[model samples]
Target: MGSLAFFIASLGFLLPLVSNANPLDKRAAALKPFNLRVTFKPAAYAVPSTIQHVQDAVACGASNGVTVTAKSGGHSYGSHGLGGEDGHLIIDMRNFSNVTVDQTAQTANIGPGGRLGNVATALYNQGKQAISHGTCPGVGVGGLTLHGGYGLSSRGRGLTLDNVLEATVVLANSTVVTASTTQNPDLFWALRGAGAAFGVVTNFKFKTFTAPENNIVFQYFFSPSSASQLATALTALQDFTRNSQPPELNMRLFLSSFTTFSGVYYGSRSDFDKIMNPLLSKMGIGSGTVSTNSWLNTLTSFSNGPLAQTGTYDTHETFFSKSLMPEYMSPEAITALSNYWNANARSNSRQWYLLFDCHGGNGSAITKVSADSTSYAHRNATFKMQFYDRVASGNYDPSWMPFLNGWVKSITDAMPSVNFGMYINYADTSLTKDEAHTHYWKDNYKKLVDVKMQYDPKRVFEGPQIVGS
Candidate 1:
C-alpha cells in the first residue's frame, strides 16, 4: 500500500511435503501467492478452506521442524508472511476470503484472506457502511489491521485495528481461540497491533460506521523554483496540520519530479475548499483539481484498484522501504530531505519517492485513545515519513545501497529531538534487530514479548524482528 510498483523475481526451491496428496496437486497450484517478488519460498503452501486444514498444515510443519507462515494477501513489505527466509510451510488463506455483515449489530465479520477492496464493496452493498483500511485493495485485512491500518479515513474514523471488536485466531499450537475485550483480553490488546508474532488471525469482527456519501479529493502539483519556496510550502503544510486541523481532511505530500499536495476531505467540495483555502492561498496554488466521488471510488483512485488482478502488479520486482514517525515537520528536516532528493533526483529510480502522511490532530480519534491502551504507540505523531526504492534485478546494488542507507541515516540523525519511530507494517529488513524492536514496539515491546511467550513459548511463529525472537 506504501507505493504500488511491480517487480519480477525468481522463486526459491520447494521442499517435499509429508501429505499423502501430491505436493503439486491442482489445489496447491491454485493457491494464489500475492507477492511474486518475494523469493522466500516455503517447503509447502496450502490453501486451507477450513480450520481443520489449517490445523493439519500446522501439524505437518511442526512434525517436520518447519515453521508455518500465514499468507493472507502476501502484501507484507518485508515478506513476513513468506517465512522471511526459507524452509517453512505457508498457509495461504485465500479460500477463507469471506465478508459477512450483521446489519442489526452494525458489525462485519471479515476473513483474513479478504482484501480491502472486497471488504469495502461487500460492506457497501450490505448497507452502505465501511471500515478504515489502507489505500491498496490487495493488502490483506489480517496484515493491515494487525499492524495498525492507516488510510484516507484513519484520522476521522480511527485505524482498522481500532474498529476491530473481536478476532478468531489460530495459535502457534494450532488451537483456535477468540480474542476480544472480555475474552482473552490480553491477547486481544496484543493482537490489535503486534499480532504477527503470536498467532494467525483467521477472522476479524469489526464495528462498522455509515459510509460518507461523497468525498472531495483535491490534487495540487507545485513546481517550487527555489529552496525558499519549498521551505515555505513545507512550513505552511505543517501549520495547516497543527493549527487548522480538520478531522475530515486527510493530506499527503509527495516529493519526486515535482512536489505534489493531495488531500481527501470527507465532505462536500465547497466545504473542503473553504477549509483548505488559507493553506492553498498561502502556498500560492492558483489552480488545482477537485472532484467528489463515492468512498469506494476514492479508494480505487488511491490504489489503482486490485493489484493482483491488474497486469501492472509487479510480481517479480522487489523493493526496500523504510518509515519514520516524526513528531512534527521541522524546517531543518525539510531542507535536509530536499537536499537529499535533489542530490539523488536523477540517480534514483523513477519509482522511488518520499511520502509524508499527515497523521495526528485535535479531532483525530487516534490521539484520543491512550497509547498504552493498544499495541500501537505512535498516537502523538503528527506525520509519518516513508523512503521507498525498488531493488534492481531482485537484489540491492552494493554501491547504491550504501549511499541510500547513509542518506536515510543522515535524515534520522539530523532530527535528534524528533520522537522518531517506525511502522512495523512498512517493515525494513535492513534495520538491526535492536533498532527494529525500539522503533516498532517502543514501550510495548516487553508486554508483546510476554504475550508471545504465553502463546508461543517455543517461538513457533518466528521471523526477523518478530517479538520474542
Candidate 2:
C-alpha cells in the first residue's frame, strides 16, 4: 500500500490516550506561526507538559501510524513546525520552558521550548554565563541549535550547536534516548545539525562560556551618491574581514534606510577603536556612535521587546526571506546589487532590507572546527546574507516573489566566482526538494539521509523540507 493509505488503514488497531487533543473543528482556527504567508491546519494537536506527556504523544502517533512534528517557538519562516503542509499531529512544546544551570561544571540544561531571550537572562543571572545564539529574542533554542545559530558572538565563541554537549530525545518509537559524543554517537552528530528530522528533543545540555565584559556597540550610516561608491564601501568592509579580523570584533552590513554598518565588539572602547580605525579610514567615514555597556544590557539593546517569550507568541510578520552563504563579493556584484536596489526600492511600497553577517576569517571560531565533524557544511562561508521583504500588515501577495528573487539574481548574475549556499534557518519555500538539499546541506546531505533512514525509517518526523521526506 502507499504511505498515506497505509497510515490511514493501520489506525483501526489501538488509539493511545494522548492528552489535550483539540477537537478537529477547533484545531483549524487556533495556533498561528510567526510567518502568516502559509496557513496550516494539523490533523490533531498535543500540548504536552512533561517528558512522559511528550512520549505518550509520540506513542499515540506511532500506534495510529500518523506523522508528528513539534512546535517550540513556532518561529519557522516556512511554518514547518506546524507540519510544513498539514494533516500531521502537532506537539506544542511551549510548556517545557526551563533553564537550569550547573555552575560547577559550567554547563546548562535548557529545555527545547525555551526562547533565546529567556535563555540569555537565566544564564546571565544564575552564573554570568552565555552561549552563542541569534539576535532575535523570540527564536527558540530548538530550531536555532538544530540548524545553525549565528549571532554577534558566533565569530568569537562559535555557533550554538558547537556548544551542545548532549540531548534527551524521544524517538519515533516513543523510546527515550540520550545522545552525546560517548553515547549514540551517530545520533549525536546528526542532532547537532539535523535534530528536527530524527526525533523530538526534550532537553539540551550545553557548555557555557563566561559572558564577555564591557561590550562596545557601534553604528555607522552612509548615504552614497552613486552605486559605485556604495560598492566601494562594501568592498572595503569585505577586505577588512578577509583575514586576521579580531575575534572580539563583529560587524554586519545593513542595506536599509541608508547603507549602514552596525555591530557589537566584545572588548573595551580603546581596543575596539584600535581594531576599527583602519576600516573607518578606508571607507572615509567619521567615527560613528560608540558606547560601552554590560553584557545583559547589550542583549536587551539588540531585541525588540523584553527578552522573554512567556505569555504568548504575539510577534508575527507576513514576509518572505532568502539567505546566501557566499565568499567575498566582487566589486562588480556589489555594484550590480546596489544599482538594482537604488533603482527599484524607491518605487515599491513593500518594506524590504538585507543584512550581510560576517562569518569566516582566520580569527573566527566558526571555521576552526573540521567540516566533517558535524552535519553543518558551510565552514568556509565568508558571510551569510539575508534578504527580507514584507507587506505592511496583511496577507502576503503572491506576485511580490519575483521582486525579491530578482534582487538576489542581480548579485549572482554579476559574479561567477562566489559559490553560494543557503542557510536553512532562513528557509525559502520556493526551492524544490533537491535544490533544498544541495543549498542547505551540500556534502552533508547524504549522511543526513542515512541518519534519517536509520532513526525514522517510516518518515514519521516529516515536513515539506525535512530530510528524507
Candidate 3:
C-alpha cells in the first residue's frame, strides 16, 4: 500500500475510535502550544492523526464559528501559527508526517507535518535524492513551501514552491481538493506563494533532484581592527554581489560583534576556490576555513553550526525577526549597519544579529521565474536581509523590543537610494495592514486579494499580516 493508504489503514489501531466528541475537549489540558512568544491561549487544540481527523476538526471549528489556525512546524517568527489572538482552534499537524518517495518518478509525497530534516533524511536514504529547503531542519515543509521556501540550493534549483507538483488542501468549507497545474490552476498559483490565507494543506507532492556528490562550505571572519579594514571588507562584499557570483553559490553576511561571510557552493572544491579566491584576496581575508563534504553532511553542518536549531519539530525558542529586500547594498548602508551595531553592542540584553542573504545570480533559477508568476514579488532583489533577536521566554521584556525595532528602522531609513520590501515568512506583527500588504505583496497585492475573495470569501484562516487581512 502507499504510505498515505497505510497511514489511514493503521489509524484505527493507533488511536481509539472516538465518536462525535470533540478531540480538543478531551486533550485540551495536555496540549503544549508551539510558541511561547505569543501569550494567547487557544480555545482548543487538535492533533490530527489522519485526514479524517483534520476534516473533523475543521468541521467542529466551523460549526462553533471559531477561527482555525493550522500549526505545521510551529516556527513562525511572529507566532502566526497561533492565530495571533485568543480563543481560536489550533490544528497541530505533527502526527500527519509521512514521506513516500517514488524513485522512478523522482518525486515525493510529503505530509504537511513532515519537517525538513525528516524529508531530507528520507530522500537521502532512498536514492541519494534531496529537495531545496531552509537551513533549519525543524521548520515544516508545509509552512516553508507556503511562504516560497528559499535555501542554499534555491539559486540553482529554484524555490521550494517551484518544485511542488501538487497539494491536497482542506478548504474553508471542509472540502478536500487537489491543487496542481491542471486542476484548480488559479488556486494552485495562489497557493504556491500565499497559501496561508486559502486553506490547510495536508500533503505536498514535490519534484525531487539527485543530490550532489560533494559540496563546499566556506566561512570568513573579519574582526576589522580598523575602519579601513572594515570598509575594505564591506566594499569587497558589495562588489562580489554586484559583479561575480555563480548560480551554484549561496552567500550570507552576518554583522554582530564582528562581521562574518559564510556560504555553500554546490560544486567541487576547486570550482568553489576558483570563484572565492579572488574575493578573499581582494578583501584581505587570509584566515577563513573552507571544507568539502558529502551533500548530507554539508546540510548537517549548516544546521548544527549556523542554524543552531538541532532539536526536533517540538523544539521551541523565543525569537523576533524582521526582513527586508533591498535592491542593492551601498557603502553608506554598510556604514549605517556598522554604526548601529557598535552603538548597541553593550546595551543589548539578549543575543541579536543581522543577516544579509545574497539572492540572485546571472543564471539564477529564482529569477528565471517571472515576478508575476507567483505571489513572491521580490524575485529581482539582490539581497534579503533580516534583523534577528533571540530572547528567553522569561527574559523577554517589552521595553527591549522597541530598541531592536528602532535599530532596524534606522538601518532601513539610511538606505534612501534603494527600494525595500519585506519577506512574508519573516512576518512582522508591528506592520499595519496596509504596510504589510504593500511590503509583502508589492505589485501582486491586488491579484492576491482577488484570489482570496474567490477561495476564502469568509476569511476562515486569518492571521496577522495574512493576504486578505
Candidate 4:
C-alpha cells in the first residue's frame, strides 16, 4: 500500500494526520529525534512512518533504551497498533515506502510502511510478480503483510507473507538487523505471523514470480436478494480448494452488499469459457452483470462498480469479525447482509457498509505456515468475515454505532467456531482489550505479548495489544 509519489515528495516535508499539530516539526538538536513522528498530546504518541539513518536514532534511543513503538500507516483500527500507550515514544515507518527490485535475485525489497502499489510496480519493473492484496493502493504494507495478506493475487499464488524471504527490524535495543529462515531462525518463525510485536520492521524482502505473460480473468456480479445464489458460488470455490485443479483456476467469493464472484485463470479467453461458462448455468444467477479485465484495469474499477464505485469516505472506523464460514454467509448471511446494506442504501444520511474479506484458495499453503508462527490464526477458514459499517464519527455520535455493531454481533454469534480472530489493524476501540486480543489473533496474542516482553522488555513497543494499559 505504498503511496509512492507522495512518499517520495515527503522526503524533507512534514505531513501530520492528527490535530493540535505537534510533530516536533523543527529538526531536533541533540535530544531532537529524526525518523520519529512524536505527538506529545494528552500523552506521548509515536508513529514509525520513516527510516532515515534509523541506526543512529535507534542508538540514541537505546541510551535509555529509548522507549518507542512503531506505527506504519494509520490503517489499523486498533489506534494504529504500534501507537504505544501511556506516554511512549514512536518511530513512524510510513516514510519508508521505497520498493526496488533486484534483477539478479529476482526479488524486491519493499518498505514495511509502503503500500502495494509501489511494491507491485517495483516487481513489475523487474518483470517479476508478488502475490499481494491490491484492493486499496493506500493500505500500508505493515499491517497488511503482518496479518497474512490475501488479495487479487491470492488464488494464483498465496498470502503476501508466504512470499517474504526476509525482513529488517529495529530491535528494542535500537539495533538494526535482518531476519530470515537462514538468519535468526526462531525470530524468523515468530515474524511470519507475530511480526508486529517483535520490532519495527523497516523493509521486507519478497520472493518474486513471473508476472502473467498475458492473463485474462472475469469478474461476475450479482444483486441476488437471497443466500442460495451466494452459496452456490461459495460452494463452487470450496470445491476448487478441495481439489487443487489446474494452476490456471482461481476463484474468490466476495460478500459485500454487492456480492462479487471474481476469478482469475492463467489461460486466455477460450480457457475461461471452458471452465466458467458452466458456472453461469450451475449457479442459477440472474440480474447479474459480467466483465473481464486486464492488468491495465484498476481495483476500484473492479470493486463496487458505478453503483458504489464512488466509494464512501470514513472519518474513522471500528472493524469487527466473527468466525463466518462459507456456510454462514450463504442463504442466511447473504440475506442478513442484503437487508443490512439495503437499509443503509436507503438512508440518504447514513453510510453503513459490510466488506467481506473473501477467504478461500485451498488451505495447504497457508496451513503450511504454522498457526503458532504468527499472530494471525484463522488457518481453518476459507474466508475471514468482515464488517465495515461507517458510523457517525465527526461529531462523536453514539447513536447508530452501538445498534449496527450489535446487529453485526448477533449475526456473528450464530457461528462461533467460525469466529477465528479479529484483525489488529481493523480494531475498534469500543471493543474491550481482551475482546480485541481473543477475537482477532487468539493464542498468538499471548505469544506476541511474550515477544514484546522479551524484545521490548521495557514495554516500549506497546500498542492497543496491551490490556488495561
Candidate 5:
C-alpha cells in the first residue's frame, strides 16, 4: 500500500486514479462498461494520457502482484476489459483518442481509444482514406482490430486487423516495445488477433486505402410465414454467397420484425444491380431499395447518430451476444435455426436479432489473407453469424443466459459435422476455459498459448477467457 501510494505521488503528470476504496459513485463511474450484463470491480482504475503513464501503471501492477487489463472502449461483451473477474488493476486508454494520418506515407497512426465512427470521419476528412471495420461507432479501435473487425466493407477490403502495419505496445513485464512484421514479429502476430492477452497496445499504424468513390447501400425485406419458407430464403442466399459473392459487394441477413437482407456495395449502381438482381430473382423476391451516397454519409446511415460517443454516460446496453464463423451453413442447420426462431422469436419479451454477415465467397479479401500470417482463426469462414438479445428495460437477468445460449446451440447441434467457431470479440462469458479454447481459436489455440508463455508467462494480462491464461 505504501509503495502504491508513493508511486502515485511520484507521478509527474495528471493521472486519474480510482481505487476500490473510493466511494461507490466514483468507482461505479470508473468501472462502467458498454455492456451491462456482467459486472466486475477492479482493484484500481488508472486513466493514462501518455505512454509514460501507461508504463508506470504496468510497473505498479507488476510490483504489486496485481493482474493488469487495458480498457480502450470498455465494450467487451463479457467485461474482459474490467479484468473479467475482479481485483485487478485496469489501465483505461480513453485519453489516447487521437487519429493522425501520414498523407505521403499513405498510413494512419490511431490511438487505442479511437472509436470506429470518429476514426472513419478523421481518416476520410484528413486523407480521403479508409480501413475496413465494423459499423458500430462506439466500438474501440483496439478491441475491434485486435479481434476481427468485420463489417460491410470487410468482404471487399480486408478486416481492420488486416490493415495493421505496426503497434507501440506496453508488455506485461513493464517494458515498452514496438511490434510489427520486422520488429518483434512474434508479438506482432499475437497482437493482431489475440492482443488483449499479450499486452496493451498504445498506438496502431495501419496501411490505408483510397475510399470508394461510389458507395451504394441496399436493403431487401421478406415476410416468411413458415420455417420452411425462411429456410428456403436462407438456403438460396447461402448457395449464392458460396458460389458468386463479389468482392465489391458486402451483405448480411437479419432476422428482425421482417426477415431482411442488406449491405453496401463499393461500386456503381449498375454493377450492383447486375449482381444483386439475379440473387433477388433466385430468392423469389423482386423489390429492394438501392441508394448511392458519399462514404461518410453511408457510414453515418449505419450508425445511430454521430459516430463518436460523446456524453456524460458513454452509451451502454443490457444485452448478451454470441457469434459463429462457419465455413458453411448446411440446409439442415438452417432449417433448424428457422424452426427455433419461428417457435420462440416473437414469444420472448426481449429485443433480439440474428445477423449473418458474409465473410467468404468467390474473391473475398478476408479469406485471401493467409490464415497462418496472423493468430486470427476462422479465415476460411463463409459467414460470420451473431445472435444478439437485449432487455427492453432495466438490467439483464442472469437467468436469461441459457435462453440465449440455447438459440445458438440449436444451430450448432443440428450441424454436428461442422465446426462453428466463436468470435472472440463477441465473447460469450458463459463458456468454460476449455470450451473457449476450441470455440474461439481452433487450430491457432496452441500457437497462442506458446506466444502467451513467451510474452506473459505469468499471465499478468489475465482474464476469464483470454488466450493462454
Candidate 6:
C-alpha cells in the first residue's frame, strides 16, 4: 500500500489533533524557509533524481529529518532561497516533465515542474495548444499559473489561470491529491493564485484552446519613444478589445527607449489587413512592417532562441499598476517606479524587463468562478500588471547592490494601488506587508491567512515570498 493508503487507514486516530499539533521545529527540523545568502544551499536537506525517481531521495531526506523542496528547472530568480539559503532537500522535478494532450477533450495534463517548451511540443504532437504565457519557454507553468501566468496570448485568453481546470497537489504531509471544483473545493480556490502558499503542485490540468494551423502576426518598432506616447499606445490597444477580431487576436505594448507592438491573430494573410488597419490608422504611426508565419515560427521569434554556448541567467519581476485604483499616480508612486527600474535593471545588472499582461478572452471567464473560489482575487480586474528587468551579475559594476537596495527603499516609500497585494509569483521576497496585502485585491489577505491556517496550521509548507512565511 502507498503512504496515502497508510494515512487513510490511520486517519481516525490523527483527526482530533491535526490542527493544534505543533509544527516540526524550524531549528530541529533541519530546514527553514530562508536565511538569505548569495549562493543558496540546502544546509540540512537536498535530494537528487534519476530518470523520474524522486521517492528514494525524498525518503532519504525524510529519514534524516529534512523536508524536500522540489524544483523543476529551478527557473525562478530566487528559487534557491527556499532551503533557508542552505538547507538542501531540493527535489528536481524535470525528469518527470512529460506532457500528454487529449485532443478530443481539448485538455492537457502538464507536469507542474515541466517547462512549457517541453509541454508545448508534446501538445503539438497531438494537435493542441493551451492558453499559456508562451513568451518564456523555460518558465514553469507551476509557478506561472500559480501566480496567474501571462503571455503573448493573454490578451485574448485571459491569464493562464483562467483556463485551468485542475491541479494535483503534494500537500505538507506528502500526500498527493487532486484539487478541482468538485473535490477539495477550498484547496482548488486556493491553488489558482496561492499555489505557492498552499503546497507543492505536482501537475496541472488545463483547458486547451485550438491552435491555428497558420498564424499571422507582426512586431513593430517605434522611434523617439516617450513614456507618455507609450502609455497612450498601450491604453489605446485596451480600447480595441471587442467581441469580434476573431477572438484569437492578442495585442501588447512594449516600452523602453524603444516601443514594440506585438500581435498574433489566427487567420490567413488577408486577415492581417483588418487587424493592423485599425491600430495603424488610429495610432497614426508612419512606418511599420507586417509579417506572416506559422504559429510556432512566431513563438520562436518571441523566445529568441539559444544564447551564447555558455549560458546561465536569473530573472526577477515586480508588478504594480498605477493605472488602476485611486485614479492617479502620486509623486511617491512615480518615484517608486523610477527608482525600482533604475536600481534593479538599467543602472544595475541582473534585473531586466517590464511586461504588462492584460487579462483577455473576457476576463469575466475567471470572475464566474467566485471571488473566494480561488486564491486569485483580482479576477474582477481586466488585466494583471507585469514588470520585467533582465540583468546578468557579470554586467554590474562595483556598487550595484547598493543601488538596488536604495531603489527598493525608494519604491516602498511610495503608495501605488488599492490592492497592496503584489502578485505572489513576481514579488521580491522582501516586499512589505502592505504591498502584499493590497497589491492583488484588498481584504483578500486575511482570508488567505485563514486558508493557510486551516490547511497547514503548523505551517509545515514553507513559502518565503508569501505572507506568514
Best by lDDT: 5
Q: What are the clashing pairs of model 5?
A: none
Ranking by TM-score: 5, 2, 1, 3, 4, 6
Instruction: Compare candidates 2 and 6 on TM-score and give the better one.
Output: 2
Error of 2 at 32 (Å): 0.8
lDDT of each: 0.74, 0.81, 0.75, 0.54, 0.84, 0.54
- lDDT for 250 in candidate 4 is 54
> Which lDDT value does model 6 have at 74?
50
lDDT of 1 by residue, 91-208 (tens): 7776677888898888999998887787788888898888988888778888899988988888898889999999998887888999998989989999988888878888899999
lDDT of 6 by residue, 143-181 (tens): 777767766666556667878889877665556678898
lDDT value, candidate 5, whole model: 0.84
Please identify model 3 stretches exceeding 4 Å from their true place: 1-35, 226-232, 305-314, 346-349, 416-419
Tens digits of per-residue lDDT for model 4 on 1-469? Answer: 1332233234433234332335344212111221122213212233334454354344444454335555555455444443523444455565687778776777888887675555565556665554556465556687678666766656556678777889898776767778887886556666766566566788888877767645565667666554444455545545545444353565555555456666566677786777666665565544444455544343444433221211211223333222333423444554554454455433425444444444543433554455665556665455555554443344335565664576565556545555545554445556676776676666666666665566667654555554212
Q: What is the C-alpha lDDT profile of model 5 across 223-296, one tens digit per residue? A: 77888878888888888777889888899888876667888998888888899888887776667788887888
Better of 2 and 4 by lDDT: 2
Best by TM-score: 5
Native-vs-model 2 lDDT? 0.81
Error of 6 at 460 (Å): 1.8
Ranking by lDDT: 5, 2, 3, 1, 4, 6
lDDT of 3 by residue, 95-198 (tens): 76788889999999898778788778888888888888888887888789988788888878888998999999988888999999898877888898788888
Report how far residue 167 has shifted in candidate 6, in Å: 2.1
Instruction: Score candidate 4 by lDDT.
Output: 0.54
